[model samples]
Target: MIIGIPQSRAFKWSYRAYVTLFFIYLALPLATVCAFAFNDSVFPSLPWEGFTWDWFFGTEAPYIGVFHESPILRSLVTSGVVAFWVSVLAVFVGTCNAFLFVRHEFRGKAILYVLMLLPLIIPGIILGISILVFSSSVANFLEDATGLWFDGLRPGLILVVLGQFSFITTFATLVISARLQKFDPSLEEAALNLGATHWGAVREVTLPFLYPAMAAAGVVAVLMSFENFNTTLMLVGSDAPLTITMYDRLKLGSTPVLNAVSLLLIVVSALLGLVSLLLQKRKD
Candidate 1:
């Protein structure tokens, strides 16, 4: 006896197999890196020299976890602080843009949206260079006129922020736009009819409705800022963010300590997401 297949069923089975292979191809490397991150080896190689958190706790190694180093810890803290602000700034401004684009009708709105999205389409390296040059030019011009030098123009923390914010805001805008498009206009109408002021209605109903999307967009902005390199490279002044510090470490030769750093970063990001999830659960 033969177990048979129809043409359509066979096609579906084959297509499903292809999709499974595609995802495995994409995910296998990340999974491997995560595994290697826990390895006790001196480098990112695989013969399974055995699992160890020695690097994590600085139990044994030349490159004790960066967490034990003051300068590296400083850079990580600086990056965290900057990323947090960028997330807040992006969400605040982007959510407003989304509300305007989705709820308000005005002249040249289509043209305006195209402009808002342009930065996201631009290459990050180019964006970084452009912001550096443009800010420096303005800073120089201002100094020439008034002899007041603004250090923020120098590729540093402020410039890194300004650069990251450019594209991150666009991301936040898109996320909020997606949420806004799905918003129920009738809810707003109903609230207004119930003697709620427009501001009150928006503050209570609209803001709460958009809160989760805002939080997600904010997380994306923070992740982008934390992992940022090109723009940070061009814009960082005398100091470095964690990404830049890691790049510098790699230039001197990479070790499993870098993997330790990456693993710690992954854990921190996961914890942040977990905190958000818990807050959302509480709200629910």
Candidate 2:
């Protein structure tokens, strides 16, 4: 009994230590980035010369310049546009697909589901290259067959949105479908029996319930779009997305300015989340 007691105690202690280390691995880098955002140095992550917001706003530091002057600002705008389109397109298409998948008893539905989810399992770099090659081919074929214009058959906005929409729509579908599955059929039947049209029933009763799920799914889709790097690199045009821009900078060197960018992203995302939650609560 004494020997077993020590062994069990050691196991428990070791498990606790492991959990602590795991959280540290996850959190330390984020903490470091957040701290360095406030650093006044030209380098994003350097020994603090003094506290400053020159990176966030602007300053007269030797190597450092204004925040707006940073290439990151342009990249940020590009990222915003991509994320917006991806989220909106994904939600619209995914909602319809999810409704069909949940409400209709169609043949080959399982196969369709598998195909929809295939991109989620595939590696992103492979997906990016595949998209580039496929879009280029399609663009050439269309141009040859019919005189129609397409974005420069390679890296460009059209390809970026298309590639992202392919997989991200699947994510949105899963989200809305999960919510749809919980719906009671009796509610729809009652509406129909009470002389409501099918469209009216869906508009008044079904859509309200799905609103929360749709919003959450959209947020997820946007976050995924914004953070995507491997895929963005292959698809984004000369106007680089933020992730690509950051990679280019890192090739040159990391900086406290990079941390400043990270900080801005974290803060902005958090603020948006908080605002969304507050509005949701107010609605409730």
Candidate 3:
């Protein structure tokens, strides 16, 4: 039997064309970047000189690969560290938020939920600027009053993690909350009836159910934190993340090393996404 609505030949061809073009639009740039990553030429663009592993492994002056480039490697490490903290914090806070919103009712619950989403609604640059200004002000006031500087409040990796956490936690909360909504309350009740304490019930029944979502949320948070640019740029101090470092390098000039970095990121992101899908499928 026929499934979807019957369409005219013209409509079918048009739909196919649209899908083809859409995929081309999406994949062409990435394909170009990946291609240039192996190009022998120093420039990332055009006239494929020849294939070479220089961009990935060369340690020569002009052919310094991403692995060999100390600055890029340092930035990669910095990004990893920031992403780790952001993921941890986002997942923990998000799990708590999921529990709070799903299992409890309180005054102004709706308002509070809306407020929690404000960070996502605001522009990233605006959010970064606001956090920077507010934190600087607070730091200044504290320093004046206490006559001691608080480096944590300055624009640094800590602030970058916090800024990213502000929005990433919302995503984590939404993911975990969606999973929580599907959970059976009777399971927890049954656990309690079986002599489990409240916390024990949650730990045994609810948390196991939420494990997949929490893991997926953590993956998303890591990817988001690693790739975040606008917010990280504002909050970053001496230790720059990969995105900021790439931006700085691009401002100077484009190179195949950057393309190699992009390719690596794309592969890593795809793997994380696959892991998320596997987790979600396991939950199902």
Inter-residue clash pairs, candidate 1: 155-235, 155-236, 155-237, 156-237
Candidate 3 clashes between residue pairs 3 or more apart in a chain or in different chains: none
Selected candidate, larger lDDT, 1 vs 2: 1
lDDT of 2 by residue, 1-284 (tens): 23544557789899999999999999898888888777777676556788877666765545353375557778788889989999999999989988989988889999988998898998888899998998889899988889987766768976888888888999899888888888888988899999999999999888887888788778878878888887877887898889898888789986567777888787778776775455334433
Ordered list by lDDT, greatest first: 3, 1, 2
User: For every model shown, what is its TM-score relative to the native structure?
Assistant: 0.84, 0.87, 0.96
**Best lDDT goes to which candidate?**
3
Per-residue accuracy of model 1 over 1-284 as CA lDDT, tens digit each = 43675568789899999999999998886677677766777787867888877666663346465557566788888999889889989999999999999989999999999999999789999999999899999999999999998888877889899899999999899887887787788998899999999999999898888888888888878888999988888898777899999899889977677777777777778777775555334432
Clashes of each: 4, 6, 0
Ordered from best to worst TM-score, the candidate numbers read 3, 2, 1
Tens-place lDDT per residue, model 3, 23-138, is 99999999988999999998998898999999999999799988899999999999999999999999999999999999899999999999988888899999899999999999
Name model 1 segments beyond 4 Å from true: 1-24, 46-48, 59-63, 267-284
lDDT of 3 at 214: 95
Better of 2 and 3 by lDDT: 3
